[model samples]
Target: MADRELEEIGEDNTLLLVDDEEPFLKRLARAMEKRGFAVETAGSVAAGRAYATARPPAYAVVDLRLEDGSGLEVVETLRETRPDCRVVVLTGYGAIATAVAAVKIGAMDYLSKPADANDVTAALLAPAGDLPPPPENPMSADRVRWEHIQRVYELCDRNVSETARRLNMHRRTLQRILAKRSPR
Candidate 1:
């Protein structure tokens, strides 16, 4: 299946992967290379932008947040340099607003963090105007709720009071939920 996708992508198999997380970035790069991409990796928005401007790739997998700036800038730069680039936005803090913004700015798809190589490959290769197939293991409602709470908590700088207030949840209740492990 991967071989067929690689063949469909043709000889311009260059791919750029941008992420601040070194380990994850390296792992994804290796995975992509094995799947037939000539991969390049950048650990900051500046590097990503520079690479996009200097040598635009056929595909890109970019993390939404970086130490220097948002990955959206890189996406924009790539689009300007090479409008044919197929880009995927990956984020640990997945929110509807950011996802919409990513797509608006020309990302082919938006994926949450911890996304595996197969999922990323599928997104990158999916045909235009076609909906992606549903996940094999979708998150349960409880897990979804827990993930939302965790995202809010991190956005609030891990301040329990602020997170609870923003969520309209009792401080004690929020604290208890935080104390427990995340649901599956």
Candidate 2:
């Protein structure tokens, strides 16, 4: 971060870190704290709502999907409670549709999962419109298709049979595709 940004982000600044993934949330909270934020964490949408309702943080990192519901619900609530607070949506199963919805609902930025503390800080500090440009070498059509299939598979409760049926894919074929890690 620039010295100007460091100066702006005071040691007393508070942040809400929400994600269903326990390890990720804890690790990120620690990292952000080291960078001078006072971090509070929640592992579900319900908990996040309660926390935000009680004390809205100056910044929030919300996972797109939580245990009880979409993190978009938390973002919407935060926006209503404290319009000035900056919120960023983070998701492993990122989709253009969800990203657009997050922004429209008042998220300052949307980031794919595994974003580092530096990235989150930068996004929160920069003017909402001053986002870094989209990647040049974006995912290919086949890669996009693979990602979408994986997301659906998960959404279908990780039921291989149901996912195959929904995609109209041969059960064995679907399993084969899922057996491998996502294509670059």
Candidate 3:
């Protein structure tokens, strides 16, 4: 799949990434680079579109929301200009409606946020509509709860008090959860 897109653009190893979260962008960019993509990142739809116009990527991972505009705009632009490019849309606010809309607008896959490099890689490179194999060791309920708490905590702008308030949890308990490494 990548080879075919590569042939069209003649840009080996290039990928366009659009996301508003700086930490996630940095982490995923590094991961993708380690996996062999020469990642070019943008934090907004406008920046992504401009970059695509100048040098369209053979692959893209676009977040559903950005600071300046909808990630759908980036998807539309890629579909119009680089139809062969493989695109995966990731979102924190995952919904059936939005997922359907993303695919209808030209995204090859729609993934929920907190997706690891392995998940993104598989989605980008897998045959359309084919799901990856299930994890060998799925998380237990406790682990899942912990992860969700962490996500919400981060979303609350890392305010322990706010996170606790939102989760209806004690501040000290939330801090304890944050301090512990994730359980397998």
Candidate 2's TM-score reads: 0.86
Local distance difference test, each candidate: 0.93, 0.87, 0.85
- Per-residue alpha-carbon lDDT of model 3 for 124-155, expressed as tens digits? 87876777677655557787687678768867
How far residue 38's Cα lies from its native spot in candidate 3, in Å, is 1.0
Off by over 4 Å in 2: 10-12, 134-145
Runs off by more than 4 Å, candidate 3? 1-11, 134-184
| lDDT tens readout by residue for model 1, 1-184 | 3668778778999999999999999999998888999999999999999999999999999999898889999999999999999999999777899999999999999998778999999899898999998888777789878889998998898999999999999999999999999787
Worst 10 residues of 3 by lDDT: 1-10
Model 3, CA-based lDDT: 0.85
Candidate 2 weakest lDDT stretch, 10 residues? 131-140
**Candidate 3, 176: how far from true, in Å?**
20
Across residues 1-184, which tens digit of lDDT does each residue of candidate 2 receive?
A: 3567667775548899999999898889998878778899999999999999999999999999887999999998899888988899998777999999999999989888667887788787777578565654566677778878989998899999999999999999999999898777
How much is 110 displaced in model 2, in angstroms?
0.6
